[model samples]
Target chain A: MELIAERGYRRTSLAAVAERAGLTQQGLLHHFPTKELLLVAVLEARDRWDLASSAASAAGSWRTGTLAQLVDYNATRPGIVQTYTVLSADSVTEDHPARAFFESRFRAVREAMAAVLRAEFGETLPGGLTPERAAPLLVAVMDGLQLQWLLDPQDVDMPAAFRDFVALLGRGGD
Target chain B: MELIAERGYRRTSLAAVAERAGLTQQGLLHHFPTKELLLVAVLEARDRWDLASSAASAAGSWRTGTLAQLVDYNATRPGIVQTYTVLSADSVTEDHPARAFFESRFRAVREAMAAVLRAEFGETLPGGLTPERAAPLLVAVMDGLQLQWLLDPQDVDMPAAFRDFVALLGRGGD
Candidate 1:
């Protein structure tokens, strides 16, 4: 991931990745057959890490707690967000290997978010404010915030903005 | 721009751009000394087109009317939005030329939006929400909406979402 971040994915090769991992190319290939597979593994690892960290942060009362923690977590790991942004942009092309990976990842992430929202709000949300409807909005906000943050990290108050947005959701605004 | 869109920017060249534009390579070089300069021109052209369209659409009423028009205009230009997204992602590197282009574009767009918002609500907005603060939120929402639209265009009701979000701002939701 660091290599890809420093030098783009197209320039980073499997051998370089293996070298970075302190393993022979053959040994790395035994675990992951192709560079695409390795990229997927890297993405999955990041996703799992995010979920685990979010879950741990929400251990007690995520439902009632402020959403600032989640926003702060994202702020700390801009690299993961940048990777997804870069890969997702590339994946928009029909033949990009990571296209399917991002599609599935997006679906899974949205589902998990919707589930969390459903659990939190229960039946109080307004009509048509179902998890499915809200999930896209939430994800969109995150993605948009990341873009702005990348452009001008100093200008974007990620946690504050997210907290306000979440509070508006809680209030059933609009 | 078409060449870069068709063939990824990294793969495209000044000669191709000149060929596409029906100009000599020296002529193109006279205008843009480097590939990065050409890309910046393309990005600026895109920004200018979007701004012009947005201004035309938003020329009438300052409140709901203009907001709706802006959303409508954005909905009609998915390609332009995608171009911006792709370029912005690529411009994350410090040395990327599109970085400065986007930074300036973002500032200019936000200023235009802030002027619109200020014209709409003036000093009477609920909670006295300044256009500066509201502008960033509105831009964030728009940026976020584009991502969702790219992923699943059918799933997002762009006009309705923007309308509702703006309406909420008119209230004290900000």
Candidate 2:
């Protein structure tokens, strides 16, 4: 699947997608009636792969190290990362189809991350933040780093920067 | 003027701009031959507003508190924040007109942030990160937080979280 979503969804047609996939347009529509549906399917497919890994790590309890590992994994797959980076930003637009998906996803992600923080640090983390408070910021650091890395891969060492952030998190808050 | 950029750039027409601005289409086109020029004009116009403030703070030496203040300013202007949030993400696409603008902007931003860190922490920061290493991550956190805030303003307290991050920066490395 060409998940590189630099091309906004509006510009991509079902016929183009069908032609690209070597499927009849009707066949493609039978499965996904709209371009937005196809986009979400692709997003979900990507998330499934990610969720599987996160599930594996859940048994061990998600740690800063696990997040750092995920960052390392992302650095290896620019196409996947770019697809997400572009789409998430696109979702912010008014009436974007992906908005609901992202909203629910972010809520779940923050909750999952909060659970991870709680498992690791009980209630308050080392820097004196509750899990609820730190979860969004942790997610933000990852999302923000991906944007920078996608834009300038040579200058931004995403994995290294994430490691640094994890270390900073370990330090007690002033 | 309509910085609420849920409407992607391509969909926004020159006629619409001219109509909205109470200018003739010919007059508007005379000033900006292409829509990209107008987009950049809006971006630069916004930057000019922001630059005036950052310039004031530069004399006092850019500090964490100054950044926190900027976040507070962004909180008041959702339209302005949404415009930047949408455009920066959109710029990641193939052949996006805003791509060059963002690339150059990011470089300058990182350099400016590095200078700020160097001023605050000399060679290295509290967590043993060099000003150069931390600059991009700092940028990432802010950008990332903005995405989360735009998506869920009711849930995310951008300014407080930034203050917390500033506190993290003040702590020594583990």
Candidate 3:
């Protein structure tokens, strides 16, 4: 991920990644047969890390739940956010390997979040905001907030903005 | 822009841009001194086009205006949006030329939007819902929606979602 950050994904080779990881090229290749595969592994690792961190944080509180923690987590990891932004934009085409990974990652994340929201609000949510609708809106806001933060981190009070947004969601009904 | 879209940006050259634009290599060089300059020009052209198109659509009807139109315009121009997203992410460092372009572009767009929003809403907007705050949120939502739409156009009803959000914004103080 650091290699992809410093040198772009295309420029960062297996040897470079191995050197950065303090492993021999052969050792790295044993794990990831190709650069594309290695990139996927990196993405998967990030997704797993985020999910684990979010889950751990969620376990601690019901009042200040996963949504708040997710916002905080995003605030701290601008690099990962930027990398995802760049890669996702680049991976728009049908055949891009990263596209599938991102698509599934996004779906899983949305579903997980929707489950949390459902658990919190239950039938109290006005008109009963379906997970499908609420999930996408939440994800869209987060993604959008990240872009705003990237453009001007100082200008965007990300956690506060998200907190306000979630508060509105809790009230439900536009 | 098409050349870069077809063959990724780094792989596409000044020669290719010239060929696509129906200009001789010398002719292209006469207009743009370097590949970077050409890329900038492409971005500038897109900016100008978007501004003009948005301005035309936003010309009349101060209140109850069509935010949906704005969303639709962006949805149709995925190429321009992708170009900006890719360049903006790459331009994280202060020294990158595209960084300045994006910063200026964002500022200009936000300011323009604030003016429009103020005109539309007058003083009815709630406390803390100033144009400055609202403008960035609007841009963030637009950007966020675009990312989601690009990933799965079928899943997102861009204009409807935006309208719902805007309606929520209008009903201030939650």
Candidate 4:
């Protein structure tokens, strides 16, 4: 994952992954037959890790606060986040192996965010924005902030910026 | 630019660029001594295109309105935007050739955005958010929205979401 994060999907060869994991190419192939399968396993592992961490942090519930916690958590683990950022952007192109995974992941994220907004703010948020309307904005800010923060950590305060956004959403609603 | 946008920086070769542009490799190298130089020129050309288009549409100025217009304009030119998206993400790697260029570009962008916010809102925006603070968010949303829109244009209304963000910034400030 660290190798993939630093080098990106196209550059991170199976040999590198095997080397990183202290396995021969043949040894690695014992567990995963192809690079695509290995990539899928890596992604699934990331999802599992995120879910486990979220569940632990939020006492088995993931809400807006938990989401904020996740952002804070991401700030501490730049490598994992970088892996995600790089892969997600790479997946935007047609025929990329990770395209469908990202597509479904984003759909799930938007829906999860909308559910959280609905729970926290009832139906409408400040300035008459629906949960559905605000959900994409929420996801956009999170991902967008990650890009800036990654590029210039000294300039972009990921956690504080996220907090400011949460405050905005928590402000006066119609 | 279209090829780079599709295949990203690492995969794009000078030969491919030469073929795409109907020039020999030597002919291309006459203008850009190296691939790195060519990449820089491409980025600069993109900035020029954006500035020229923004100036024409916004009457020789760039405000939040112009920024929104740029987003609308970007939707119409997915190739350039995708090139930007892919390259920007790839550039996040510490050793990427475009890293310094992106860093400086972001710094200038943040400063420009700060000036714009300060001009429009006079020092502070709603919720006491300084222009310095809000500038990153503005830039983040623009870039972030591009990612989401690129992934699923049918679902993500990039312009409308941007307008909503501008509205958020405009509301209830000192």
Candidate 5:
């Protein structure tokens, strides 16, 4: 994660990842035969942090505080966050190794986000938007803020911006 | 522009770009002494389209229709859109060639967006959020949607999603 965070996926080598992991190349190959497989593992490991937060939401704790906490946690771990941000955007390219991984992950993410939103706001959110429609925009804002914050951390304030967006989402019915 | 659009900055070579433009390496080098200089030129060239739209906003014509039209136009030009999406995200890495370019561009883009939003909605928008606070979110949504759309063009309708967001932006006043 650190290697890819600094150099990006295209420049990072498998041998380097293995060295960082304290495993021989052959040993690494035994568990994951290809670089794409390694990339998926790295992504899943990173996403596990978010999935745990979502699970907390499912258990009724992932509100504004939890969301803000997640953002703050991410801010402290710039290396992991940077790896995820750079790779996800890079996945947009044709023939990128992580393209399919991100595509399916996004499909599931949008669905999960919609489900959570539906639970919170009923079938439709405030301002007459169905949870389905609002889910992608929510996802977009989070992803988008990450890009800006990563580029200009001093000005972006990822946590505060997200809180404001959530406030916006919950507005308009009053 | 087309070269970097297809291969990304690191993967693209100066020689290939020169060949594509019917210029000798010497001629290209005279114009842009380094690859990073060429990259800035390509990025600036691409940004001219957006700058023109922002200019229109300054002239009082860049509202929902123009915003949607810009997204629709970008949808038709995947190569150029892909170049911007990939490179901008890639710029977050340490010592990346386009880091300064994107950092400053985002500052300017955010400031410009804030000015336009303030003009349309006043100092504080309907939800009691300031235009300065709202501008980064708007930029994030646009950029974030582009990333998702490029990855899964069939599943994600970039322009339509942006249109939904614009409508959402206008909704709270009612």
Candidate 6:
């Protein structure tokens, strides 16, 4: 993941991964036969970490504040955020192996977010948007802030921007 | 730009760019000496197109609606957006050639956006947030929406979502 995050997926070969992990190419191949497979594992591992941490923080349920807390947590780990930003952008192509994973992952995220919004703001949110409609905007803002922050951390305060967004959500219907 | 957008920066060579442009490698390199230089030229060209269009649309000044119009225009050009997405992600590295360009561009964009917001909503916006503080959020949402729309055009309505964000901004102090 670190290799791919630094050089992007296409440039990061399995040999480099083996070298970084201190394993022979054959040894690495034995564990994950292909680069694509290794990528999938890396992605899955990241998701697992997010889930475990979220679970640990919220007792297995994602609250409205969970997303904000997650943003705060993300600020601490530039590597993971960089990896995700690089891979997610790469995955948008039609032939990218991670395309399906991100597509479904977004759908699931939107649904989960909408549920959280619904819990906080009832059926409809501010500006006459349903939770479903508001959910994607929330997701987009977070992802987008990561991109801007990664580019210029001195200017883009990830956590403060996220808190402002949360405040935006809180003031939506009023 | 299309070749890099499709294949990503590291994987794209001068040969592929030359082939796409119907020029020999030497011919292409005559203009852009190295791959990094070529990438920089492509980014600058894209920005030129944007400035040209924006200037043409708003008489050299941007308005609140200009952002939405830009998003709508962006929807018509998936290739450019994809190139930007791919390159921007790749540029997050500390030493990427385009790093300074994006950093400064964001600074300029945020200042310009804050100016627009202040013009439209005065110093303090809804929720008592200043326009300067609000500018990055607007920029973040626009870029974020692009990522989601690029990934799932069928499911994500880029223009509508942007319009919705504008509406959110308008209702900020109401």
Index of the highest-TM-score prediction: 2
Give the deviation of candidate 2 from the true structure as CA RMSD: 3.0
Query: Which ten contiguous residues of candidate 1 chain A have the minimum total lDDT?
Result: A58-67
lDDT score at residue B153, model 3, on the 0-100 scale = 75
In candidate 1, position B57 carries an lDDT of 52
lDDT for A39 in candidate 6 is 75
**Candidate 6 TM-score restricted to chain A:** 0.84
Instruction: Residues A1-174, candidate 1: write the lDDT tens digits.
Output: 788766755567888988999999999999999787787778789767655666644564444243467668768766656666666765654466776777777777677667667777764443336666666667667777777777788877777666655655565522
lDDT of each: 0.68, 0.78, 0.68, 0.81, 0.79, 0.80
Model 1, first chain, TM-score of: 0.77
Give the C-alpha lDDT of model 5: 0.79
**Candidate 3 lDDT by residue in tens digits, A1-174:** 777667654466899989988999999999998776787787778876766666554573333256688679768766667666667665664467677776777777677667767767664343345655666667777777776677777777888777766765666532
Model 1: per-residue lDDT, tens digit, B10-116?
56788888898899999999999987677677778875665566555555434556657767876876655666666777676557767877777777767777787
**DockQ, candidate no. 5:** 0.58
Instruction: List, residue by residue over B68-107, the lDDT tens digit for candidate 3.
Output: 6757776766665666555665666435667667777777
Task: Give the range where candidate 6 chain A is weakest over 10 consecutive residues by summed lDDT.
Answer: A55-64
lDDT per residue, candidate 2, A17-66, as tens digits? 89888999999999998776787788789777776768656576777777
**DockQ each:** 0.38, 0.58, 0.36, 0.49, 0.58, 0.51
Per candidate, the number of residue pairs that clash is: 0, 0, 0, 0, 0, 0
Chain B alone, model 1: TM-score?
Answer: 0.73
Candidates 1 and 3, the one with greater DockQ:
1
Candidate 6 wrong stretches, greater than 4 Å: A1-22, A33-37, A55-60, A172-174, B1-13, B16-22, B55-60, B172-174
Ten residues in sequence with the least summed lDDT for candidate 6 chain B: B53-62
Following a full C-alpha superposition, what root-mean-square deviation does model 3 have from the true structure? 3.9
Ranking by lDDT: 4, 6, 5, 2, 1, 3
Off by over 4 Å in 3: A1-16, A33-37, A55-64, A123-129, A172-174, B1-13, B33-39, B54-66, B93-95, B122-128, B172-174
- lDDT string, candidate 5, A1-174, tens digits: 788767665667889988998999999999988887787788898777576656675676455456667788887766667777877877776678788899999999888778767666677666578888888888898889999999999999998898878777777442
lDDT of 2 by residue, B69-108 (tens): 8999988876657667777876766677888898888899
